[model samples]
Target: MRHTDDKELIRLLRLSDYAAFEELHHRYWLKLHKLAYRKIGDRQDTYDLVQELFIEIWEKRGTLNFGEELPGWLQKRLWFKLSGFFRKRGFNGKHQENFRQYLENQGFDKCFDPAELREVNACYEDLLAAINKTIEEMPNRMREVFILHRRQQHTVDEISDKLNLSPKTVRNQLDRAIARLRRSTEAYDATALEILFIVWLIF
Candidate 1:
């Protein structure tokens, strides 16, 4: 029926009504997907984030809040998720530049067999991208120092000389970067091997 109301649907959804949820998805799938894809800017990332969000909504049906408009609720949740996406990577100006330069320095062009580069490029790009404009919010010297030492594999003295700063300052910046990466990647709570499912993503 064209009479569908989000409030009624949300109520039914909380009661484990598959028909209501399915209908809601059918009605809003395109709109939600498009908004998510724009923020994430990657097809798979968009799909994965949406799937996780909806799945959580399904699992927490009983506690789901929908006193206001459902579309507005979704918008708020999407923005929150986009914010989480940035925090998850510990992204900052220098950290981000370091990552870019590291990729270039490693010659991403040469890292893969030429024939396989396309596939690798697609996957890696999908991983790094998402909505987060605050990447430029880092302090200048902090960003520069973090990038030089951690990303470029520079020694503390090398970074100090390159930036005309003290070695102790470089060391402190490196420590902060290390702290950020630790916090960001810690969300997955797994090592690369585990993520690969070679040992299972969870123990």
Candidate 2:
């Protein structure tokens, strides 16, 4: 009767209730679409990924735990699928090259085993979510500086010119943004912390 309860839906799902699956799909599909679109930046790919995600969810429904963290689990699964896409394309050269170099510069040189890589990639997804949360919590000027530097990939001088602020002010704002993010994520485990550091290094 509790159709909106994820635990109830998951219970029905495990029992092969198509309607329950449909309800879950209806609830989450748009949010998943936006998430996939933001990550892949390709409309066709986002649609394909969303389709694949739900199909897999249905096929594997019996195995699901139906925990409170199902949404986070879904996000981690999507990141894994996104990594597979990157692997198939051999990382598209320049983007992967820059990412790898950025990590190396942050003192991460050892090759990650498949399991390690998957874990790190999942942490990357978590860090992205954390960054978004931190940005939303930041003061307006600090948020502007953070988004310009992180999302738009602007240089300090570039952001200063665009925002009509002195370069020192821009740098200080950026530093404050980083400090805020660091404080927010301080509770993460050591390995996830390293992944977050790599993300900051790259941006």
Candidate 3:
């Protein structure tokens, strides 16, 4: 069986040809959705974005110029859609511009460095284990309160309400837990892994 040319498939799609559109979808759906998913992160939002983009293609097929460059056209549309999503979430201008630059210059499909990522992951795990050991040595209520409030993203007020402690107690536990984490993590250099761990603790 002969594979269809992507440009030809797009041309047919613009001519209201559903068969060619289906072939195009089969050829590019996974790649496009993977790109979108990495940017969007949420599973449901990824699905919705991909579905919406294709629905838009069909809905606007009549106005599309068949000779258009498929990759550029598709990516431009996707980026605009993604930007609108980001804007809705309150991304500042600089953040949006940087994201656009990254996608355009660095190439979205090739963002991750496998070996470096592995080292970062290993360092992160080590930091976690050290922090866990420190926390485990803490007295009972302190450890529980620290983990529940700090590590689990609960607000001090919520932690206090849930544990029947004062908000001041919750904050104190968090400060102590973070100080302990800082001591355990300080042995590492300021690698991305260490930086991430420090930021996590401080935040």
- The candidate scoring highest on TM-score is 2
Model 3: lDDT equals: 0.60
TM, every model: 0.43, 0.49, 0.43
lDDT of 3 by residue, 124-176 (tens): 44454565567768778888887675446576788888999999988888778
Q: Rate the local accuracy (lDDT) of all candidates.
A: 0.53, 0.66, 0.60
lDDT of each residue in 1-203, candidate 1, tens digit only:
23768888888898899888787777776777776664445677678777777777778889877647787677556655544554464334433343344444434434422222111212222222211111124467776775565335687888888888888888887667545544443544533322111100000
Best by lDDT: 2
RMSD of each: 12.8, 8.3, 17.3
lDDT minimum window of 10 residues, candidate 2: 112-121
Candidate 2: tens digits of C-alpha lDDT, residues 116-181: 332233344455556556767899999888778765668889998999999999989988987887
**How many residue pairs clash per model?**
0, 0, 0
- TM-score of decoy 1: 0.43
| Worst 10-residue lDDT window, candidate 1 | 194-203
What is the model-wide C-alpha lDDT for candidate 2?
A: 0.66
Ranking by lDDT: 2, 3, 1
Off by over 4 Å in 2: 1-3, 92-203
